[model samples]
Target: SEGKTSFGMSIFNLSNAIMGSGILGLAYAMANTGIVLFLILLILIAVMSAYSIHLLLKSADVVGTRAYEMLGLRAYGQAGKIIAACVVTIHNIGAMSTYLYIVKIELPFVILGLLGKEKDFGGWYVDGNYLITIVSVCVILPLALMRRLGYLGYTSGVSLLCMVFFLISVIFKKFVMECPLKSIDPYSNNGNKTLDPRVMSSHINSDFMATPFTTLMRSHNDSDFIPRFIPVMISSHTAHDCREAKMFTLTPEAIYSIPIVAFAFVCHPEVLPIYTELRKPTKKRMQNVANISILAMFIMYLLTAVFGYLTFYGNVEDELLKSYSASDTLILCVRLAVLVAVTLTVPVVLFPPSSSGFCDKWHR
Candidate 1:
């Protein structure tokens, strides 16, 4: 009771748990599902997540236990408890892995960008495996080792701020980036037109033109390579062709998009712990926390997905930040913010599984 967290801190922790590396991929999901359908799915998932939290809290009150596994045990038997614990453990582990993987992939690039050597990837400093290991040992390990979830409230607040900065940067970039109208030269072989190699490379390697030729061209120096391949390369196009954002449609990839949208609201596993640590723990108060956190995240996720998808339209990458030019100073700063946000989130995601393990041992 002495270390109980106030309502604001509890909200911070829950909000951090809800927002993670999943935000980076929402734009791609929106691209696949279209604007109207994506908004519908997002709203549905947020409401479902809040309702599930309410049910979980009600069940906990009835059983007189805050432990999720114990709730399962009361409802069923040993098998139910085991199943509940295993499911929570597996889901949190996957979430933690995803956060760390973002660190691994993006940290090196952030370091290189800060050093003004974005192309320099030859050192151990730029190695993703090494960066992730150092970060885990230096940053995440200490935060994860804290005995109380409340202690993470401060860090969670900072993480949420970083995401807000990221969201704002995304909206700003949408206005500044211009789509190249004549991104491809169709009559190059007929000696009537020519293409800028830089423009061509940007369109092929960075935009939505994902083809075998684009993949092959990325391996070579663009200036030297594009001239030789200009005669045969006719399939290449630009983001101008993809400027129309879909309003009401779904691609075959919606199968994957649905899961992405659903899982983006997964703060259920962290709800009870936050509730347990609340300054004035009550079902009504905790439900309010859940509602506020989900609502906050829903707005952030929607703004991020909408602006990000609008910027790239059909050309948006799985990672929204990757769709931008790496040399853009603002985007580089955004990359850093995103990297920090995900890195700090690792500790929050790590808590559920670790606490579950400690609970099991204490019970024994």
Candidate 2:
């Protein structure tokens, strides 16, 4: 009891595990899948994830051991144990790498923004590799050294707050940011026909208001996976059109979005450890913790995907934040907040393998 974690902290830890850099890609995934299809996929994944946890907890109970590897051992001897350990190690290592990669990509811009320099300004400080090294040593390493998984709960709470800020910023930006982004070039200037901005804006306003209910569903053949440009009365105003909304899509891009959505919910490996540390730990209680955590992340993920997709429409980039202007103060702050969230998350991701004895040598 002395070293156990409360339900609230356990939720925080598990919530942090559920959320990561994967969230930034949800909008892009939505762009490919469309609003309706994406929501359906998301709800299905969340339900499946919870059900998977239920099976895991049930298995651990029957095996009379809390360790995932031990459950494997009971089921299939040493081979199962090793396979389990390897799978956990590989998955978590990949998760850690993804988190660090976010740090590498975004840290430079964050530092540059703080220093009032151009996003492209040159310096060793702005070098992603160098910044990642510094962050690894100064931030992640120390946190990863903690012996108990429960200790990281405080940092996890902080990390969740950062993501909440990111979510709020995305929702706020949806209202403030307009479509057919002025920063993006609609047409190449290489002796090509160009439309006047004033005329285009007027067309957007008039056509969008007059034909508010007009819907067009572009037909796509099974082999036609390429994104096609559909001509509309107004050039870029089509983004706001109901016709652009695809209830379902069979494109290769939509298929590719499946993995992104699936992987975004991978917190199963971390479940047992948190369950073991849970105060007055019981199968039913831990299940409640897992369910609540998944639900919270589900809300955040859905809101983030919907609002972010609405903001950028089909033009949304894989990394949603990258699609925004770096010079915007609000976006800059969101960037830093994201950096903090992911940086703190690396240590939590490291815990599964490290506790499994995968990092025994380093600890010794």
Candidate 3:
């Protein structure tokens, strides 16, 4: 009965919600749980996330309650409503904080890159405290002020494009370029030796399973038949022929990676609203939207993790972009991409909480 969102816009909005700052950590997740296991976990989480959305939609359809908090009220009365509201509030607050934190830490770098000033500009724009505030006022506040959820889809599409740029950059950097930091690893002799291309390619070919993404459809543990595949970093400056590559051990600590991946795929709070706003408003179409959105994110997440892990190997940092040397111009653009994407994504995340509160007040 309200303004309806078209199928494509719905897909873009949901996908934007599904993809977030959480993706930057996925390479680290892959590092913790080798390339093989990371794919498995990603698929598993995506399947579960999609199934959960289906259940939420089915519940809403059967109960005739489209809002998440309202669905909570239908299922469990006032207590359910309160619990749902609080969960949505807490979830959105955490998400908003993370988005703001991304702006805080990354905005200065983006501005510095644009200004061509490698150093701080010594003003409010450079300060982490004020940077987020400035971005919130200049960027997020306008998007958040929109009266309808569907109106934000245009910005959401742009945000998704930013992430797409990031994914492309990771893939491009992996094949076409070498990070200058590779030659500068302190562990390498003299910090000036170039990796022999032949030696590097040989190791990449030999340990094909564990390195990069050639082994995408395969799985192996240290205890598996192949066992103990190490990533070699060869130094051309050395008279010695081959250096021992660092073996990325399959550790028992894979548990830490699951939550972050799970966090990345979260779009439950926004699901009901999107479903409600769908033009046809059928359960089947909404389910398709959820599936398609999750599938798109699945591909992006796996690619980001695979390429990023391949690029850094055992040295993948918590934030994949941070793994790049600060001076790399290509990486600076990718950083800006993430900042813009997250900046726009904040309002999409913020909408559910604020709208849910309004719905609660109206119900009263």
Best TM-score goes to which candidate?
2
Residue 100 of model 1 has an lDDT of 87
TM-score of 2: 0.84
Ranking by TM-score: 2, 1, 3
Candidate 1: pairs in clash = none
Global fold similarity of model 1 (TM-score): 0.83
- Over 4 Å off, model 3: 179-249, 357-364
Per-residue accuracy of model 3 over 1-364 as CA lDDT, tens digit each: 7438999999998999999899999988887887777777888899999999988888888998788778778889999988999899899889989889878988887778777887896977788888778788989998887767898889999999999999999999888644322333322454333334324444443212222312212235633232123333322322221222222446565677889887878999889878878898899999999999999999999999888877766556788887776777888888988889999899989888878854546435
What are the clashing pairs of model 2?
none
Alpha-carbon shift of residue 10 in model 1 (angstroms): 0.8
TM-score of each: 0.83, 0.84, 0.80
lDDT of every predicted structure (CA atoms)? 0.80, 0.82, 0.77
Give, for candidate 1, the lowest lDDT window spanning 10 residues: 227-236
| RMSD to true structure for each model, in Å | 6.3, 9.0, 11.2
